[model samples]
Target: MSDKKFELSRRNALIGLGTVGLASAGAGVGTSAYFSDEESFEDNTLTAGELDLFVDYWTGANSEAIDGGTTGSGQNDGGVSAQYVLNDVKPGDSGKLVFCPKIVDNPAWLWAGSSGFTQYENDLTEPEAEVDDTGGDPGAGNGELADNIQVTVAYCEPSDDLEGSDPSGPEDFETVRELNNPEDYTLTDLLLELQYGYLLDGYVEEGGEWVPTDDGAYPASPDSDTQTGPCICIEWNVPTTVGNVIQSDSVEFDLGFYAEQERHNENPTSPYATGTTDDLYPPFDSNRALGMSIQGSGGSGSAEAEIHNATSGNTAFPFGNANDDSDNFPADQDVDFTATLDVDSNTASLEVLGSQAGGTDVTASDTDVTDGQGDGNALGSDTEWQNGGIPQTVDVAISARSLNSDTTTVKNLTLNGTSVSPDQLAASAGPEQTYLVLQGIDSSAGNTIEIDGTLNIEGDASGWSGIDGLVINWR
Candidate 1:
């Protein structure tokens, strides 16, 4: 028979932080594809292709851990079980299926340390305290009195097809899906969508009693006629190894007193109550029905080509329909395909190239410097200096201002041992006498000129002194 195609959606999309690679095209990886044709998928219905089944387990509000126990405290710890049956297809042809449970609205309240009774009493009014000891307080030297409970479902591939014969024993026929740690699994809000069915009604066995009322609570007697519903109870120890599937045996939960008390409070006139007297009220009952269905799509036109893990080659694997049906298969159709890791030399080189572009490098530097000064003599004017024997010349200007008086003038100015007056200068100045040294002047033009490295000026009549100067070189 021709292979079929399919597309699977994630059930708990936001719960985990891991990436699930698609099987390769010869082996699909990192992609979700669908089939385009409908005819091919229908034609391959009877073909021996793989089948994928997803099973979900659901629990009612009362099924969660009540007060401090693993089951409810008030009513019988009765729960319901449900089964979702699907067509048996081949192993590889089926699409991915995910099962999730509904989130509990009213979680079980926990009582810490040895104060279970004290905590319970604190939560209730005086009249409600009458039934406090029905379940035996955890502090009363009785073992921990747990009022909370939980229901879970396990999934396994059946040894024998629903209709086929099996030589394997019952043990061999069942594959156990262990659910030892309820805390590790994802709890969803989807369980509310399931259709409930009854498996065990309100039946609390001996020594399996719980408090049933806030006032004068007592051990719950088995009631075949009690309003019952279905619930799936998972065993704490489920097998991890895969094999054939088996039907689970009836399990027990401690339906503590609160469930029955709440139920009684809801319907004071319930038939299960002892008297019609309004003040003499009975405890409440819990709803236990549970069911769920997960739908998906498939077809041959939608078959995904993936890389094979062992052969390292591309191959087609059947992913179910867009709408999760096993009957439809479209032939010779265009389907999406993805490639898996084929780390050849070229691929490795590309990866290395990508890394190189994002890297950085650091290094050191090189250069030089020179310093020289000539004719160390004190000068009262700005002057120019030049390298010996160089035709290039440098110019300098100097001036002094009077602080006490508004008028100021230059006293003496010199450059390279040559005396020069402010009047001999060419540059313009303010009210003060300033000297401007012309660099291109005769023999002095090529002479190196220097000062005490400082020019200090004192004003005469004004008794004020201010110095301002500028030096310049020209090549």
Candidate 2:
């Protein structure tokens, strides 16, 4: 590790260069008899360590009216504690609020834009808007900003964080991340797009004409880069077409600023020459960036979308309040939690069966059924007996295979949502199979049967863990 202490300078002078030869000449006879020694010393001084980052709201063209102008202070400035807020903001409101991130004591490298930054959206789409420059007309090429709310960033003078206009001079700002084209953005894309080396209206004078340049992007540096400024101006916007589905919607985020040694940027580690334990132990050091949370509440009279179940799939049980009515549900309510099972009579038969007793093959006799019940291979020759058509003697076979060393209990069976306790289901312990039979059934269309019970799982159950809702439909 390098020294982190601040050092003071000590001055010393050497003035005996020519005297060395003269002194030796006179003492040539006995060199050691007239021995003389002179010593020169220099001090090694170190500088103090520094890494700091901060985020604050920038009141455009006026620093005194930062936080609603009540006391002319932004959050965390002086005694003010209220964070930056954008209220009653509808769509198409551009440049509503401007903020700046400041770094000092060390050079800061930042990551921004949709590619690197992430904002949680509660799984809903963000509001979309047209580029503010398009004059509210989204027909312009690459004009649409997919999210209902959008944030655009530009480099600005470090000393003045309140500027609303883009940087005009080459020395005004440094780009850390580049913004994405408006058309390529999604509703969930990062609100703030910071494109390195790309500027908003960024240009330079060459001869008589202004040539475009990468807006705020520049190389990383250990010391502050004088060619560009240290602060970035951030803006937010809402378009007019954003509907009420976003009503009462909100957005919160943390802006990050990172600082690392410039040495890493110049000579980074590669696969061939990865660092040793000592070199990689400390990882990298950086100061924490101060964060600010800005919240925007949607307008009143917000509408909601309706929820509907699939028409063809298994029936979906109601989730708490989602089944209350057919209209809209609150955006912040829990909707679904029930387990589902969909069964069709066409493929509801258990085609696989086996039986064992005392380590002997007993399936041949135990799995077959005579009259109604049997012990060995008790499945009757007639397979469609359980099919509900004209009410007749229906032989319903039940088989249980125990995967572990403990007995499993087949709780209760239900037919048409009504309990039928006489049909018992149980699997013996340790690879043992048990069978039961039902003799009467009107298995027909609209008749539903299900095993409504829990499996008493033993130390280990490889085949069947348990069943909560196992249903078979006869349609």
lDDT of 1 by residue, 1-475 (tens): 0111111111110011011111100111234344447565433222222111111222112211111211111111112222111112111211112212111111111100000011111122233234332222222211111111122344332243545542231122233343222221211101110101111112212342322233322222123222111112332212223111111101111111112122224322112111113322222111210000000110122212111100111212233422333311122122211111111110100000111222111110001000011112111111122223222332232322221232332233445455554322111212122223333333233233332112222222111211111111121
Give the Å shift of residue 348 in candidate 1: 60
Among all windows of 10 consecutive residues in model 1, the one with the lowest summed lDDT is: 289-298
The sequence of per-residue lDDT tens digits that candidate 2 reaches over residues 1-475 is 1111111111110000000000000000212123334653334344444443333433321222122321112322112232333333444444323334333333334332211212122222223222122222112111222235555544444324426554332233334433322322323233222111111222333463434444222232233222223345544455566554333333332232323323235322111111114321221111100000000010111111111101111112111122333221121221211111112332221110111111111101112111222221112112222324223222333333342234444345444456554444454533333433333455344443333322222332222211111112111
TM-score of 1: 0.14
| Candidate 2: 10-residue stretch with minimal lDDT | 16-25
Task: Tell me each candidate's TM-score.
Answer: 0.14, 0.30
lDDT scores in order:
0.20, 0.27
